[model samples]
Target: MTTENVDTLEFNPISAASRNGGYVALGTLGGKCVVLSNLSKNVVKLSPSDMKEMDLKTVCGADWCDDNYTYFHPKQEVMVFDLRRLATDIIRECQVKGVYVESYERKSGVWLMPDGGLAVNSRKLWRPDGTVLEHGIHAERIYSASGDIGFDLDTPAANDDEVQCVLNAFGGINWRNNLGAEMLLGWFGVAIASVAMRRRPHMLLTGAAGVGKSTALEMMKWLSGKLAYASTGPQTMAAFYQALAGTSRAVILDEFEADPSRRHSRDTLEIARMSYSLQEGDEGIVRGTPGGTARSYTFYSPFLAACINPAKFEPADVTRWVVLEAISRKPDAVALKEAEARVIGPRLARRFINRWANFQKNEAIVRKHIIDAGGDGRMADTVGVLLASYWTFVSALPATDSEAAKLVELLDIQDRIALHAITDEQRCLEAMMSKVLPFKFMDGIALVTRNLSIAEAIQRICDDPTGNLEITMRLAQLGMRVGCVQGTWRMFVANSPEHQELRKVFGGTKWASGGWSTVLRRLPGGTEGTQRIGAGFGAAKVTIFNMPADLLPANDGSALLAA
Candidate 1:
């Protein structure tokens, strides 16, 4: 290399500090002499061959002196041997400090470039006062394989209406309602904030075959710009995890399904489950490596999935997803252009880079708005980030009254969905109530009725003793009993072979192992302690769940109840 070229290479201050302190004799990584280069604007590792090929004196830059040439470079191979020996001796004891990163990263609210510049966005270098830096200092040193990689900003320069243009184009999709479009916008905001936010929500687009789900996903990919990894159907769990392993970039998948019956589907769902919360310390999903050790991965990436049939997840997993349904396109509806998104995306990214601090400040206001409107804490985490981020961008501009009102409508719609969501326990109870518990009566003749719940059958037997004689006798044979406990009705379900069918109703529930009492106690007016109640079935003191006398109205015990 030429002297002029070598003059531009930046000396490593961290290595100098470490050498002076004697923490490490040489700040070498992977058997190479590592230094910061201002020309490349990256931490460059140079091997002995590389040093030998370059103009040694010039490449040494400010670190060079006459003594350094006599002791270290008199014989090039000897210096290599010496460095290799030193590496062997102190490698385990010393904590080497240097910029070993190979990709773009965000640290402490500042974006770090591979070229050693501090960027405000993918395109512009950062300045403290919200202006672009022309020739900023190449001084920030970050050590991470955790990539928040950036791409070239190919959009037009920021204009006054950039954010509005992005939103208006998004609203052009064939979404079922205004709420769906608004929520999609909110999710886009969440994706923009993925690197910094702790609790990120996922998005799912659903509709019939021709509803433009793929088009919507394509728009998101452009808007995500450099921060998104797009995948199609038939994805493997390993590939999916590898794509998101160390990055916080959003994953946008079209025709994605997570059916548990398939091994890969289950694995994909499991990765999604693990990505939801940022747990304490290094808690994460562990996979065994070929080296016989384990690598723990915690992904903070948000996922956007598009599918025709919705994937069924356990209730907890369901809460993590924000599903947007598409509608049949009107004949004149303008199709979303991937080309337009490519430009608008970078523009939105620039806006996010500038407004991130303000977005953090508005979080409290957004959270209160959601909770006060009857949304729960989960909704606060899942929906609040979306609303806050979108609000931050719009409020930065001169927002119209209609823009502000639409936000309120979004919250109102989310609140209603949250309030009406059925709990897992409620689903199990509903299934149980619809079940017909058969028994033999009248000298081995089987008795069955589709017009009553287990509770109502007992209620009928208690209310009309003589008329329900056959029913009462049949229930006694099955060891089922019912009676009033402190003025509230309770049913004692005996642990008998005849009652085994009831346990199937609790499948995929917290009470799946037949531990129905634990979950049933969480129901309204239900008690943790089982009641010992006598019944028309013969006064047997069996332990069972307590239910309010009128908790479940009579139902034809045929099919499972709708949630």
Candidate 2:
């Protein structure tokens, strides 16, 4: 390679083979490999031609099949080379230095790394045509060759008694209104049993303080076989991954705190996102041969679950996870007292262990529903399953109006919060209206007006009369004579009953010419003669001549002025 191009080439040493006085293998810039060695302290590069003269017995190590190794060095970047093609002329001439290699087997048209050794980097498992097969970090190992590697899952006999036991352990006392807890149980119980359609069915349980989230998780643990529990925090990624390695179908991540350093809550949401898919890794092995001792690693299972407080989670998190909110309220004090007196935790656990099979069957049904719904079904169904499963736990709790309303609001707000499409003031007003308004107000109108439209008008009315009176006095100011006269209130616009009715409604009066004279008398400018002339009155009771209907065209003249 040219000197300029050499800068881009990466080299890795195959540690296991090289440590045994073997030729150090190297991966080329273009993902090819070569071997290098030191002969009498003079660094000697070994090409494919050199390999023919060298005895296989004399050589400490040789790049067998590139498929057998993957390279990952802490200092240099990682790459994979196909040793099966090592005899090719292109690979024969390449200088392999600072390059590492790992073995892989082509099985079912897919390349798989051997047992006891995992692919150092998951991205290397791609098709010969360069299509990436795996995209994320391999957090779990799947061992196909090791018959001894197995998962321990509890298999309770399938029967109604067992089912009831599991249901009772999951807090399934009754079915009505225990939606959240029931759904939680279905998800967790089925998930622990490894019955989820997807390899990973992450459960997220959130609720207010003093609610039984942690306690419920503890109960689940007692119901299942040995489970690994990890308490996640802002810096728990390493710990979380490490803990995930030890378990098969179940992992309880408790007290997960959303890192505040992020712009949003749930700093490790990215990790949570990846857990939806399965990952592969290698397991280490120890073998002794006449040549020397060898160590290898392989891949194994993927299944995990997590629980977090709602305050520490973002709305977007609720979408990816099966979310269950726990409410702390005792529906029936007497029943709760009796259950508490009975020490039901152990009874519940016993029931769960008994009905584990039915839980698995029901989980299968739920998984089919999820698949039928086409990848992450609507949030309601996802949450509904959990509520249905844990129904008995919260059934005895009396429902509070505030709690019910909060649940409804939470459901509605999720769409907005998840999408970030609502204004802060609108959210505030919703809270206020929900608390203060007796009658249901139009949410659309409230959103459009921002609660300020009517609120501002009302405030002004209570603040100043002159400014406020304009709202009530606009019609009278529009040249409509409106007031009381004699014993009745009247409003006259061309001396019509329509005007009179309007007058009654508005509490006003109107007359032909006499009323106009009475109003003018109260005005700044008025003369006795002018008043009498304007009034046209000649009797004890004020009277005025009614103008002919068409004396002045209705369109052009005021009937009072014409009279």
- The residue ranges of model 1 lying beyond 4 angstroms of the native Cα positions read 1-80, 95-160, 258-260, 279-281, 397-406, 418-420, 440-481, 491-502, 505-511, 530-563
Query: Model 2, stretches more than 4 Å misplaced?
Result: 1-159, 172-177, 193-196, 199-201, 208-210, 232-235, 245-249, 257-267, 277-309, 329-381, 384-563
lDDT for each residue of candidate 2 in 1-563, tens digit (9 for 90 to 100): 11112332222222333233333333343233433431111123344444442332134233432222335545666655433333342244344234332222111111223332112112133322234333221222121111111111221223344434444443522222344444444554334323122334456566665555565665555444333343443434444445443233355656654545553234245545444433333332224445353433221221223334343434344454655555553453112232341333333433333343343344345434433433334343344234323432333232233433433343343442343332232332222213211112224335122323322322322333233343223322222222223422222222222334223322322222223334333322222231111123222222122222222233322322322
Clashes within 3 Å, all models in order: 1, 62
lDDT of each candidate versus the true structure: 0.55, 0.34
lDDT by residue (1-563, candidate 1, tens digit) is 01111122223222332112111112354445554332222334555566541333333332332322224456464442233433332332222433233222232223434542335433444442445543212443332212233433333334558666666656666675546665676677677656556677887788889877887788888877778888888677778667776556688888776565667555656777777776323447677766464556566677888998777766676778777778775565554477777767766666665666666666666666666666777777777677767777667743344544456565565544653376676665665565565532333364544445555566565554344666655555544555444544555554432344445544554554665555555666554333323343334324456655464334412111210
Give the range of the ten consecutive residues with the poorest summed lDDT in model 2.
143-152
Q: How far is candidate 2 from the true structure (C-alpha RMSD, Å)?
A: 23.1
Compute the lDDT of residue 216 as modeled in candidate 1.
77
